[model samples]
Target: MTAADTFETILEMRARAVEDLLGSLLDERILPGEIARPARLLQAMRHGVLNGGKRLRPFLVVESAGLFGADQDAALRVAAALECVHCYSLIHDDLPAMDDDDLRRGQPTVHKAYDEATAILAGDSLLTLAFDILADEATAIAADRRAALVLALARAAGAGGMAGGQALDLDAERTQPDEAGIITLQAMKTGALIRFACEAGAIVAGAPAADRERLAEFGSAIGLAFQLADDLLDLTSDTTTLGKTAGKDVAAGKATLVQLHGPDWTRRQLDGLVLQARELLKPYGAAASTLKLAANFVATRRK
Candidate 1:
C-alpha cells in the first residue's frame, strides 16, 4: 500500500481494536445485588465510556506497543485502561461546576444526559475501573512490567499530572493566564495522559531504556501538537464539525495559542511540533510510519 493507504489501514485497525476493547468492558456482566441500583451507575458509566470518541489515546498505546513487537491483545488491554481514565476525565470536566459543557463527541454530555450526581459517580467509577482492569487477569505482560505500567498511569492521571494540570487550568481561568501559562497548563492537563499512553505501551513491550525515552519524547511532542490543534480548531471550526461546543474557549476568556500567537503562528508551531515528534520516532524505521502519520493527523486535523 501507498503511505496514505497504509495510514488509513492502520487507523482502521486501531479503531477496531479500541472498539473491541471498549465493547468487552461495556458488555461484561455486573454482578447482581452488588450495590443498590447499580444498574443506573453502570449504565451511566457505559454511556460515557462507550460514547463515540476518536480513541486517539488507546490507538497511540497500541501503536507504540507494535513498535516493540508486543502482542496486540496485551497492548489493547493497556489501551482500554487508558481510555477509561480519559473518558472519566471528560465526564467530570463537562459537569456544571467544571466546564459545564452540554455536548461531547457529537452527543449530549454525561451531565446533560443524566444528572450531575450520576455523572460524577460515573466518572469516579470509570477511573477506579481503569486501575481494576489494568490489574485484572486480562493483562498478559510480565509482573514487573505490569507494575511499572500501573505506576506510570497513576502518575500521569494523578495529582502531579493531568489532575494537577486541570487544577491549574481552573485557577488560570479566574486570572486569565498568559500564553506560556496556557501551554504549561495544557502540557500537563492534556499531555500527561498522551505521554502515559505511549509510555505504557513501551512498558508492556519491554522496550529498552533508550527506546522508551525516545517514545516518551515522541509522545510529549505529539501531545503538545494535539493541544495546539485543538486550540486552533476551537477558533476555526464550528460546533457541528467539532462535535462539541465551539467558541466556548474564547467565550470563557481562556488563554489559548490562538489568543496569544494568532492562528497562523499557532499553525506554524503545530508543524514544528509534528516535525519534532516524527524525528523522535526515526529509530523505529518502517514501524514508525503509523506514529508519523498520527502526529501529522494531530497537527492537521480540522476537528
Candidate 2:
C-alpha cells in the first residue's frame, strides 16, 4: 500500500479496535445486571463512550506501540485502558457543575441522558475499571510494566494533568487569559493524557529511553495541536458538522488559542506544531509514517 493508504488503513483498524473493546467493556463490565433497575444509567455510560468519536487517545497508544515493535494484542489492553480514562473524564466534564453541556459525540450528555447521580457513578466506575483492566492477570502486562502504565495513566488523569488543566480552564473562564496562560491550560488539561497515551504504548512495548522520549515529544506536540484545531473548529464549524454544540467555547468564555490569536494565525500555529511533531519522528524511518499522518490528521480534522 502507498504510505497514505497504509496510514488510512491503520487509522480504520485502530478505530474499529477501540469501538469493539469499548462495546465489550460496556456490555460485560457496565451493564451486566450489577446495578439495580436503572437501565438508563448503563445506557448513558455506553452512549458517552461508544458514540462516534475519533478515539484519538487509543489510536496514539496503538501507534506508539507499533513504533516499539509491540504486537497489537499486547497494545489492545492499554488502548482500552486509555479510552476508559478518557471517557470517564468526558463524563465528569459534562456534569451540571462542569461544562453543563447537553451533547457529546452527537448524543445527549450522560447527565442529560440519565441523571446527575447516575452520571457521577458511571464516571467513577469507568475510572476504576481502567485500572482494573490494566491489572487483569489474564490480559495483564508484566507487573512492573503494569505498575508503570498505571502510574503514567493516573498522573495524566489526576490533578497534575487533565484535572488540573481543567481547573485552570474553569478559572480562566471568568477572566481573559494571556496566550501563555491559555497554552499552559491546554497543555495540562488536554496534552497530558495524549502524552500518556504515547508513553504508555512505549512502556508496554518496552521501548528504550531515547525512543520513549521521542514519542513523548511527538505526543505533546500533537496534543497541543489537537487543542488548537479544536479551538479553530469551534469558531469555524457548525453544530451539525461538529456533532456537538459548536461555538460553546465562546459562550462559556473559555480562553482558547483562537481567542488569543485569530483563526488565520491559529491555523499557522497548528501547522508548525504538526511539522515539529513529524520532525521528531524522522529517526524512526518508514515506521513513523503513521505517526506523521496521524499528526496531520489531527491538525486538519474538521470536528
Candidate 3:
C-alpha cells in the first residue's frame, strides 16, 4: 500500500489502541482509603478523552520512536501518557471560563456532559495521571529517560508552552498580535507537545542527539502547518464538518496567521512548511516516508 494510505490505516489503529488503553487505565487507578472510582469524575474524563478523534500526538510518538527501532509497546505507553495531557487540556479548554464551548469531538464537552466543577477535577486528574503513567515501570524506559520525558512534558504543558500560548491567545482577542507574536503563540500553544511527541521517540530509543533534534524540528514544522491548516479550516469550513463550532476564531477576534496573511498566502506557506518538515527526514530515506506522509496529512486535512 502507499505510504499515505498506510498513514491513515496506522492512525486509525493507534487511535483505537489509545481508546482501549485509556478505558482500562481509568478503571484500574486506586486511591488511598477510597474503594471505588469516583464515577462522575471518571465519566467526565472518559467523556473528554474517549470521544474518538485522530490521536495525532500519539501517532507522532509511535512513528518517531519507530524510526529509532524503539520497542513498540513502550512507545505506546509513552504515547498514551502524552495523550492524557492532550485530553486534559481539551477538557479545560472547553470549560465555561476558557473557550466556553459546548461540544468537543462531536459530543458534549466535559463541562456540558457533567458540570464545571467535575470538568475541572477531571482535567486535573488526567494531567496528574499522565505523570503517574510516566513514572510507572511499565513504560520500560530507564529512570533518567523518564525524568527527561517528565521535564519535557512539563515545559510543554506549563507556562513556557501550551498554557502560556493559551494566555496569549486570550489576550490577543483584546489586542492585535504582530505576526511574530502570533507565530510564537501558536508554537507554544499547539507545537510544543507535538515537538515532544517526535522527540520522545528518540529519547525512548536512546537515539543519537542529532537524530532527536531533526525529528523535533520536523515536529515543530508540522505543528505550524497543523495550526495554519486549522485556522484555514475555521475560515472555510462549517461547524458540522469541523466537529466543533466554526468561525469562532473570527468571532472571538483571535489573532491567527491566517488573519494576518489571508487564505491564499497561508495555504502557500503551509505547502512550504510541509516540505521543510519532510526534508528533515531525507537522510533516513524510506524509513521516514511515514513521517513525510504525516506532514502532508497535517497540511492538507480538511478538518
Top lDDT prediction, candidate number? 3
TM-score of 1: 0.93
Segments in model 3 whose C-alpha atoms lie over 4 Å from true places: 1-3, 29-36
How does each model score on lDDT? 0.86, 0.84, 0.88
**TM-scores of all models?**
0.93, 0.91, 0.95
| Model 2 lDDT, residue 278, Cα | 94
Model 1 over residues 1-24: C-alpha lDDT tens digits?
A: 777577767777787778777777
Query: Between candidates 1 and 3, which one is better according to TM-score?
Result: 3
lDDT digits (tens) for residues 1-303 of candidate 2:
866677667787888888898787677443343455355666767877887666788899998898888867768888988888889899999998987888775678888878899999889878887887777664456788888888888988899889998898888867677888887888899999999988888898888888888888899999999998998999999988987778988888777778776899998898899889999989889887888999998898877
Query: Model 3: how far is 86 from its true place, Å?
Result: 0.6
Per-residue lDDT for 1-69 in model 3, tens only?
Answer: 876788899789989987888888888478454577887788788888887879999999989999989
Output the lDDT of residue 31, model 2. 31
At residue 60, give the lDDT of candidate 3. Answer: 94
